[model samples]
Target: MEEVYEFLKNAKTWYLATVDEEGNPQVRPFGAQNIFEGKLYIQTGLKKKVAKQMLSHPRIAITGMYQGKWIRLNADAIYDARIEAQQSMLDANPGLKHMYQAGDGNTAVFYLKNAVAEICSFTEAPEIIRF
Candidate 1:
């Protein structure tokens, strides 16, 4: 999980994929990521379609690239509504304060569970980590 978090944090921006109501894939760029209690967390808003889709289907895939290497993380995003979780995410990403406040009714956070992460590079063999 730390490796996954490091890759995402270093990349700064990653694309998350969720399945919509009709089973179509929805992909969007996300910039906030943090690790709390040995888990990787991502933030979103309850009012957003991505959150809704995630609630219905917990499986998600995230991809990002940094320094000619790429990472792919697939996990079951379990919702973590605890205030501490929200605070942890906000604290890790101060810039998010502009869009969301800790404990706000609209703010939602999910931690990646049962995660499989792959680090790949054209010049090196792939490394796979599961947590």
Candidate 2:
């Protein structure tokens, strides 16, 4: 889990894939990531389409590339309604404070649960890490 977090941090940006209401795939770049209470958390605005899609479909896949290596993470993105989770995400990403604050009605945070993360490269075999 820690490795996944570190890789994502180093990659700086990850593409998150979610399904729309029509069963179409939607992918977007996301930069905010946080780990709280052993869970990997991501932040977004509740008003965003991604948030609505995620709410309807909890399953998501995230992929990022860094230094000739890449990672693909698949999980059930469970919404954590706790204010502490929101606060943790805000604390991890202070820049987001300008756009979102803890307990704000528009702030949404989801944590990856029952995840399977794979790190891969052309030169090396894929490494599977599950949490």
All candidates' TM-scores?
Answer: 0.98, 0.98
lDDT of 1 by residue, 11-92 (tens): 9999999999999999999999998887889999989999999999999999999999999889999999898999999999
lDDT of each: 0.93, 0.94
Q: Give the TM-score of candidate 1.
A: 0.98
Clashes of 2: 0
In the range 25-104, model 2's lDDT, one tens digit per residue, is 99999999999999899989999999999999999999999999999999999988789999999999999999998888
Give every collision pair in model 1: none
